[model samples]
Target chain A: MKDSKKQYIRGEINKTGQSSSVGLIIRQKEPNNLETPFDQVDSFLTPMELFYIRSHFPTPKLELASYQLHVDGAVRNPLSLSYNELRDMPSETRVATLECAGNSRVFLIPQAEGAQWELGAVGNAEWTGVPLGALLERAGIEEHACEVVFEGADRGTPKELPIPPGPISYARSLPRDKAMQQEVLIAYQMNGHDLPQDHGYPVRAIVPGHYGMASVKWLTRIYTVREPFRGYWQTSDYGYWDYLDGKPVRRALAEMKLKSEIARPRVYETLAPNQAHTVFGAAWAGETEVTEVAVSIDGGQTWAQAEFLDPIQRHAWRRWKFDWLTPKKPGQYILLARAKDANGNVQPDQHDQNYGSYVINHPLPIEVFVDDLGRPGR
Target chain B: MKDSKKQYIRGEINKTGQSSSVGLIIRQKEPNNLETPFDQVDSFLTPMELFYIRSHFPTPKLELASYQLHVDGAVRNPLSLSYNELRDMPSETRVATLECAGNSRVFLIPQAEGAQWELGAVGNAEWTGVPLGALLERAGIEEHACEVVFEGADRGTPKELPIPPGPISYARSLPRDKAMQQEVLIAYQMNGHDLPQDHGYPVRAIVPGHYGMASVKWLTRIYTVREPFRGYWQTSDYGYWDYLDGKPVRRALAEMKLKSEIARPRVYETLAPNQAHTVFGAAWAGETEVTEVAVSIDGGQTWAQAEFLDPIQRHAWRRWKFDWLTPKKPGQYILLARAKDANGNVQPDQHDQNYGSYVINHPLPIEVFVDDLGRPGR
Candidate 1:
């Protein structure tokens, strides 16, 4: 790679990743943001073909032979490593879930703008990559470094906003402490395969314990900033109200909020009356793992504990299932899934909309109907 | 106020109101926003000179001879009233406390934007006026009216904002129900005198139980709006987070928050050790009158009930006092006041800054020190 400024090109939208086999729900057509059918998620490791895809811009066309990840800015040693070089570095694979901040935006009353997504904009997968700390260590980080900013090759002027931003390379910055963590990865593979172009090609950031927006795709540059990054995306978009020194202010989006989704018995799905049924779902949290998944079968008036099918991992969502004997009477019933984190941060009945159109992690009311002719698990 | 737009002249600020007798603290100079020194508030009626002044623009200059109040918009009968005609209408006198939403903003950590007032941007004044409801009734308000907008003659392009709006009149709206309330006033007088230039001379709206902003000064136009008013003053400037159908959104600033201010033993005041001092203050709340005021002589660790000096009055602040004996060995002491409303809404230790520099109704910590040489009354 040459000068990033000179080589920067705002690529075109990817039209090839919408594979019919995955049956992924397309939240957006251009830039290719596809969601998995969360109800169909049957395993701990979300199949690569069925995993959710979120992109801020068009997929950049980069050749592996010439691809290089540049590590500079506030560093004693600035180095550029090729795709093979990154792959040859100390590698680790771990299962982590990535959920879009705006996952349940469709549930917001008065409807907020931007990606009206429901559930399925989340998935857990085994990401194979080199710890970002190793690359930063080799680059010899500076003491004054405060932020590790990641800039991707995908650059485009976002045309959706009233005042479009300048040509932006989908980027995000991590605090120096988070960047130094061994779990923070410069991922080269997804589910034991080379990074897919539909995702980030060659390499991308896999930020565990954070929202997917923090995981910059189509990686091209890693820079240590002496001060906090104030990019438009960091300040304007993908930010929420955070208190600093007891004053409410806009803060860059980070940690994914605790959430639980009822994968089975989907919203408005029909079920047979007086039949045995299984209610299954996935729960996830940031920083702390979700410790409890309670399924409420009566519009949150009463709750029944759900048993975890998948073993708990550091950053993976736990799959929980609840066995239910459908009521004999035919009527409308509301189902809700609520997750509690290790810190006792229970999913609130309502989320503070200060998060704007993002972090819509409130307990969703999924109204399902019971009818005599309806199938139990259709 | 004939042909308000044509007669609209954004008057220059009055420089003569900085009377030293009142000792009012000037928060802003050009547009004349003065805050009362709450510690000196010795009575329930905040003296005209001591009362706070909040203005978005310069003091509008108007001639009573030519003044005309226009009642239009969503009304069956649009009428204009002359100054004498409005004064001839059934006159009423009501004592109501008006408070700036940004009062006590200086206490906010990391600080917030707008006026950095340290309490005392409030005052209970005896308002002499005609009920705005009477004027609206004569105008025959349409059934579809959702809001009653009050527009003051004060008009200017607010220079402080990054995007200065086009020449705009200071305007705010009340819900249809609140507008028709007899307590809502159209005043041409203040404290037994013709309204002073600094305090909206010819006529103004005295929206009892609401913040001062809703009481539009220099009021020139009264209009019934079919939809909720989305003017910049109602939307951009004075707004707080409110939940509608369970979604947090920007809501126009309305009712003043419950508050208690220590009039005596003010912030950082020095007191003599082993001496008895009267801890006196005032407490006020909107819609609901303050039922109880608690004084904490040693910060908030312990509290003692305060006795009301003035009889409780609707829409008026209640003056409260507590007898406190200075600790014998006191080197430093923290004084705090907490008020609980009739609705049981107690003053919180911390206010939600989501109110955004407004509704700063937090229990303020007033640090006072005891010195052996300091005079007891000092």
Candidate 2:
């Protein structure tokens, strides 16, 4: 939570980049801009408070006593549940990493632009909750129905969506199939403690896969429609780029891209001659397993195999490591890492910058310092 | 977002005594409590804001000015980025729905267990951002690296994880291969506006189909490690019971199940004489696509074909409808809808609840209204 607690996991930059009120290079005062020092070299995981915060608005505080979740409409029984009541119901849990679509936007060349997050906009966590499908069955549904609509507590008109014939707000729909999947959870706890106020306290829905928007926060209502939800969020925003048309196209929901990242050795570290350094990073898939990972030094000239620490959690990130023999003569060394999932998705050297930000797969790089003795330096 | 805008969809109770939130429900704050109203008439997509909301905690209002996303540890460049800079980089967008592992958890019984969300938990929206892989590439990874860690603004030390030795934060990791796919996104906008303050505004990551926790909101930092994340969220909280060992094996990430729901006739509605009624709903899958949808008015005794409406998106939801001839009797009529996707995954009649509150799929039902003359009541 403080710069002092921020461990220097990765090495230090010889010179600072730009300055902002929100980051290490830039001194920021908001939680969104809070940065942890990288000196602490713990094993693989990053602590929670030290984790980066990516928020759209300010953290909201709600009186637990006044909060309630309501279920009604096409259901035979209408009910209102308190946080305690929700917790009392059957509990379930899941481990996942939520990454912003623009976390790595800084690398895009020609600056086809949008959010400039270099790579500090993502985190992984465990969510605990009750399955949403269970509550619907309790409500007792009627026949002759079609679509399920999700609503959130956030209020604002998105600029990207077309104004609907009716008053527009944020909303999206799921087909009956997805609506019934139990993975959909009304989560109440993060890790093991109560949900954080900043994360959506009292309760939030954990929708696996898809983009973050579909996982509406501060959830308030549920709508069942025979027609598709045509809210501004659906028709106008987050659609897709028509690569062929060189314009936007109507596409399916976005899923996690095959991805990999280095987890240690903050850049610009000096290595002494004949020293051995260990490299670390993570990889993941939307719903599939991470089958393999490869690492390359010398600007990706050649590659070697990396080891995945845990292969049991298929959808979860797999830790990998490769031992780098210190360079005999150190000048400037560029370290590169890339990975592939079981699905045959290969990372791209670089992504095409489009107006509507989407689909990026570029190799990650790191710089290592090897002293004349060829050993890692202090 | 007002209570008047929310809606809930539903269908008839099934053999498992389960129902689904298939239609639109409205949210209205009344003197009594949060008023959630369901529409029993025409099946149509629910409007945004009017859509349902499901969350695990109070919505966080992130201030972009103070938000800082940090990329450190195990890279050539350990940098921090601000919201404004993120907007200047290349951007991407996609239409996707994030469904909770427990979205339809109501289907679970022994008496409805866990987070009691009745269908408003999931939402569809257009997500925009840069791929996390792109940023990692710019950071320059080193060899002997294993994993990348993601952290959020929310803080809590819950169940202890097995990865790191100390009390770690909520975090998860990805192996190298899966981390570099095109699907992974560092999102800055949702439904086309700066992300709503409640959602991970300034930034968040979208990981397609795995689970919501994987898509960390209010993202703040990225860490590289040799082992996968072992925070409470990953090891103890989100892990599932697989029934693999003599006891249930803990499954790490929640996977979606094949499911369906009906979103038409309001329960307890009266049917008029000689009036035609329409049956509607939508469908989805983890890796497969919903290819077929079927409807039944006689409670599984008989079934008829339904029509599918595709608006161009693939994974979002495919609207489906069926027209039924007016019934000749005045007795209660039951309606049901089911789907089959491109991968041939069919909606199941009943899905058993898993231990970790993961993806569940169950058949959907609808109760039609009938009058003395055998017609549907409006």
Worst 10 residues of 2 chain B by lDDT: B27-36
Model 2 lDDT per residue over A41-156, tens place: 13233445444444443444666887777765567787688877877999888866656555566566655344565555555567788887787777765564455666555544
Stretches of model 1 off by over 4 angstroms after superposition: A1-378, B1-20, B159-165, B374-378
Write the residue-wise lDDT of candidate 2 on B1-378 in tens digits.
332232323223111222333334422221111111223312233333333443333445568788888876678887788888777778778665566566655545544444554444455556788888887887776565566667666544332222222333335555555566666678987655566554566687776655556767777877665433434454344555343111122335634555556655545566665666665555555445667778887888887778876552554666667776668666787777777767766776765544334465666455666775432344
Interface RMSD of each: 16.6, 20.9
Q: How many backbone clashes does candidate 2 have?
A: 303
Task: Give candidate 1's whole-model lDDT.
Answer: 0.79
- Model 1, B1-378: lDDT tens digits are 223212222112111234234477989997999998877666556667667999988888999899999999899999898999899999899999999888889998878778889878989888899998898889999999988888889988754221222466777889999988879889977777677788999899999899889999888888887756655565446755453222233457898888998877777878888777788788888998899999887778998999988887999999888878888885888889999998898997787855767888888888998887745343
DockQ of each: 0.02, 0.01
Which number leads on TM-score? 1
Interface RMSD of 1: 16.6
Q: What TM-score describes the B chain of model 2?
A: 0.77
Q: State the TM-score, rounded to 2 decimals, of chain A in model 2.
A: 0.79
Which candidate wins on lDDT? 1
